[model samples]
Target: MNTYHIDAYKDDIYTCVRSRCGFCFHACPVFLSKGFETYTSRGKCMIMKAFLEGKLPASQGLADRFALCTTCGYCTSVCDVDRPEIFNAFREDLRDAGYTIHRHDEIKETVEKQHSPYGSPDESLASRFAWKIDHGSPLLYYAGCTARYRERAIAEAMMMVLPSFDFLEEAMCCGSVLYRTGYRDDAMRQARALVSRIERYSTVVTTCAGCYKTLTRDYPVMGLQIRPEVLHSTQYLVREYKEGRLALSPVGKGTKVTYHDPCHLGRGTGEYDAPRILLEAMGYEVIEMEHAREMALCCGAGGGLKSINDTMATRIGSMRMDEAKRTGASLLVTACPFCVRNLRDAGGSELDVVDITELIAQSARHEK
Candidate 1:
């Protein structure tokens, strides 16, 4: 039993560190991958205690383990107290150690080189679909680096159904890559620049849960009060439908689907309803995994894990997708591009993983 972490975790970050925050065990894909007692939240707390007490110095493997965490906030959500800010505090620890992965390094390098995360976002990418940067609207549609690169279809879905908002697709990083990898200064610098660019917008929308949380919660702490608004597609869509802005018909008339909450969207930002609502509204028979909503498992691609631990990350994703499969659903719907990409790679057609927007678009009769 280790105790004493650091000044950042000096307080009872958890209401009761003694109790196992089994949320991770219940919903975390990483624990499923390792299955070691040490991989669970109890293990994480012990490890942090060792660091605080100087019993364990942060070694390379230890650092790797730390980096492996998806920072999904599942542990914190289940904790009665402290609520898991330790993960955020760990970013400072990584910065001190000067440890980073290629994903973070590549994106930060690109951001420093290019104005945005994507070094060379061709107009063709956006033009390939109907979505445009400026559609005479107040919202800024951030496609994020992942969607801009591989998951281009998700962007196309955004163009078709949610066409009413203004769009700003960045080939640039969201400072999330840097933030998660322990480059706080670089992350803040990028966040400031982004805040400057989008300050005038009435709202900011994103397809990436990572980007959504980064802009909504982290940026504000850095004095980037992004006033317009930050919303994931699911949330915005639900709002739109309620406001009469979106007319969601029963698109998934007969499809059976299950939803996997992105770590950032579900736990980071406390969003769990809009997506389920969207599925239910669309006539898709939505199924629930044992670990649903805040207790949702991570796809293991987050916290730069996909960058540093590809094999393990894929394994973790497979574990989660396996759970979706158990629900007996035809499709597994996720709101984050990272989750969608990783889950697809792991599933390899064993299951169908789709972005919420694309799922809707497939069955949707566009209003416009």
Candidate 2:
């Protein structure tokens, strides 16, 4: 067995180290916040190269540097190298070498015990939304950890807009943070457990970009084939609107709002238009930020960075918030609940931050 995950990507690591194109530098959220080439994808590739060449040993300091990444994949957007995959593999190698970050280790433990990194939810979903659930419905609404625990309103909004759907009685973690933080084995175990519970559903919809990406992309890559079709809430809602099965009541009434594409949903899954379409349908004039869609900046909360180094994460999020403000929009809307939480933390009272589903719930007239 290959003890080091990076061994599978030796050639790719060498390619990044040799190219040294710096295409991934200025746009890297960690690099932008830390002002260090070591935080850039190429710079990290150089570190991996050094490790492979036996020049650098795995150490606590090295692990901390690797943990700073948001895994946003912006580097891969500009270049041929799959930087996020390589970086994640390198993190696994570091973890196996006993250089794991403390917070990440705690999270792994929490997820193993509680099925969540955010701890037990303050309230039970079954108690809160039991009346709205249809247990026999083919469609299931999966409220991911952050939505169920931290941003309850996003889940509530999704329930208000969705018609005839069943919900998981309790929110599950989905192992996104574990997978991103170098606990792939633990993540796989969690994935298998969650997969067994939801495979009966024909479709699983969620308001979290992180959970959508994990279930649709990462789970399969980890060799756990999910049976249900996974759709981000934006994708599901837009389809209903386009098919004339859903109605919107012009809640925005021409108010200008800018959309921020979540990294996992946009760069990870190639979903760029659904959220914007839904926003426009609800009567909001959409403004394009300087960095929107493919080139959009990360909200700085993904890949366990928020738990590891919150100050740096908030600084990077504040930068994205500034970009939204420059567009002169009154509200900043996004599809993912995680994006809303981090951007809100960074922006504070400066501008309103909302999930697309939240805005949709306000405008929905439930034509069906």
Candidate 3:
């Protein structure tokens, strides 16, 4: 059945192993945090090579090492070779070999039962969409799990800025968590369900970067396709502002703001300009952090790492927050709900972290 999709990357994996290039070393969040070669992309590739060559057997220890990665695709952005695809395939192989993390399993089970990875009490899909408004516009807002559950403020902000859009009352987990955690079958199942629900819309707008990337990038990779055009809220807002459909009251001059590029939005989907464009349009002085855009540091909540190793995830997020603090910006803004949650959790009261939509909504209220 060619389950792992590893055969196609066999040659590339060999080339990477032979080159022994360290280009992706500093790019990995886990490796940068732990200072271990085994946590880097190159290190993960080496382990996969050994497994493919039958030099090592699958073990819990090996699985644990693989689980450390956030899979933020920073290495893929920098690597001369395609490392993300190979790494994803390696994860599939690990799962197929019956090696899976317990937290990931629990998440998958929760998703299967409750249509959410949060493992919260069962709630009707309608309850999640209680805030939904059907403006009868072709655009539909798919507020992914984190935004709908953990961070309702992001969704509320989106509702404030968007003129008229339908909410995906049938929306479930976008399976981003499952896909990154190596539950391919479960992820595909969720993807199929989401695709079916969104087929009626002409365009799908996502407030969550993970949902945006999953719908636009990961679903197609899994051979599941949605007919509607998908846009991140920032992308949609930028387009609206550019087209003169959306207006924003300018922030006070010299209001310094810095942006964090969520890995899924930046490295995963090649969207580095939209959020910045929106911020600049709002008359805020946008400062660049040391790692912004393509080289942006992960917020450390991705790839089920937050679920598996929260302490490590928070440590990485705190480091990124430190970088933001160094920018001397009064506010840190990002496009992803997951990034907002993780960065806020790590930054605490030291830094103000907000989603772009929240800022936009605030600007709109100021115009009143």
Candidate 4:
């Protein structure tokens, strides 16, 4: 029987076990919601130590505890020591011990069979690029699964905002869903496939935070070499605006708008300024949420948590919406399609949630 082991993470496990600092306690959304130490990073590390030392056996309950995390990287952002690595290692250990989440398994099967985690047979390689443009540029706009299927408006808005990029006709899953759900080998395979598809492009632009992070950060970490430079659409827009490639129409003065930093975009990649800069340039009053930038709260759609327990995900997203409400902004804008989807679902009638690209496209000034 395969058993949980921490040999690779011995140093991090020891540090977390010995310190018990609780620095990462409040940073974990799961811990805050569950009100249990077990849901916190430090607590999870302790559980890993126990399993490694043979004091505890790998069980479904333990697996569930690890799954509670959204893996937003907030704990690691605030921790003096590396917390994300230890948490991820524990997840891998859980999978190795014959424990895995059913939803994650389903996602893996879907991605393997359909090239999408959504399990929709309608979404094929051909359908992904049905809106392709032959701009004759070496730039490829990779509308990831979320943007392509779930948040079609974001993809359409991206095309409107920049009508000169080629869409990848053969883009597959970015494997972020697989990696975050502890299917490392499957994620690696997806990464290899994705790299081969876009390596010829000079730049790969993505509208999904998960895809941006996966291509720019996770792929290299997994030893997959993607030759093209990766840029988030927000980042690319900022450059376009700076280089006079794109023009924006200013909104009415005092038009209040707030920005929600998507986990993978803000904390995961430290890109909190470009979107705000664009908003400010568009003449909207960019109000900062109480938990803005590095400390921004997640929209609860990440790390496959939405698939596992949608009720919990909705609750978390509602909490974020409440914060956005506190800002007194008429609109809540985010750079990620996933964030827009969850925030819109949770915001309901109370708030209006929109992707930055949508806002930009609507306000774009087309020069005749």
TM-score of each: 0.88, 0.97, 0.94, 0.94
**TM-score winner:** 2
| Model 4 worst lDDT run, 10 consecutive residues | 121-130
Give the whole-model CA lDDT for all candidates, comma-separated.
0.74, 0.88, 0.83, 0.82
lDDT of 3 by residue, 169-262 (tens): 5438888888887778889998898888788899899989989988898888899878999999999888888777888789635799999999
Q: What is the Cα-based TM-score of model 4?
A: 0.94
What clash count does candidate 1 reach? 8
lDDT of 1 by residue, 40-91 (tens): 6667677776677778776656666666677777766766433334654554
The C-alpha RMSD of each candidate to the native structure, in angstroms, is 3.4, 1.3, 2.5, 2.3
Candidate 2 lDDT, 149-268, residue by residue in tens: 889999898988887789877657799998898888898888888999998999999999999999998887888898888999999988888888899889988699999999999999
RMSD of 2: 1.3
Off by over 4 Å in 2: 1-3
Between candidates 1 and 3, the one scoring higher on lDDT is: 3
